[model samples]
Target: MTVTIESVITCPSCSHQAAEIMPTDACAYFYECTSCHLLLKPLAGDCCVFCSYGSAKCPPSQEQKGCCA
Candidate 1:
């Protein structure tokens, strides 16, 4: 199955719009805020981009596999 998800992040420091894609096979650990140049990481207990921003949770999380598993 082709698993693709999109999410948007607003930099807390600069209010920059970051449109990103969540990978199905891997979890992204860090994201650089384009506008503020701040490095973004998953919030406490969050697994991936979808869990943080997307309308739906990450695929693994949805399956109860947890993040990056």
Candidate 2:
């Protein structure tokens, strides 16, 4: 099955708006916010930045198997 997720995330430190593409096969550990040039990584124990703060979960995590595993 094909999985997808979309969300608007703001950097916690810089409040930068970041539009991210959640990968179906892997978790994104780091995201660079274009607006504020902030480098974001998943919070401890989270799979991706989306999971840490975005309104939506990453595509891999949305699957029944869970994120990147």
For residues 1-69, could you state the per-residue lDDT of candidate 1 as single tens digits?
Answer: 544466666665677776776676788776788777787776778976457645566667766777775
Clashes of 1: 0
Name the top TM-score candidate.
2
Local distance difference test scores for all models: 0.68, 0.77
**Could you give candidate 2's per-residue lDDT for residues 11-60 as a string of tens digits?**
88777676766666777778887877778899888888888978778876
lDDT value for candidate 2?
A: 0.77
Q: List where candidate 1 sits over 4 angstroms from the true fold.
A: 1-4, 53-56
Residue 47's lDDT in candidate 2? 80
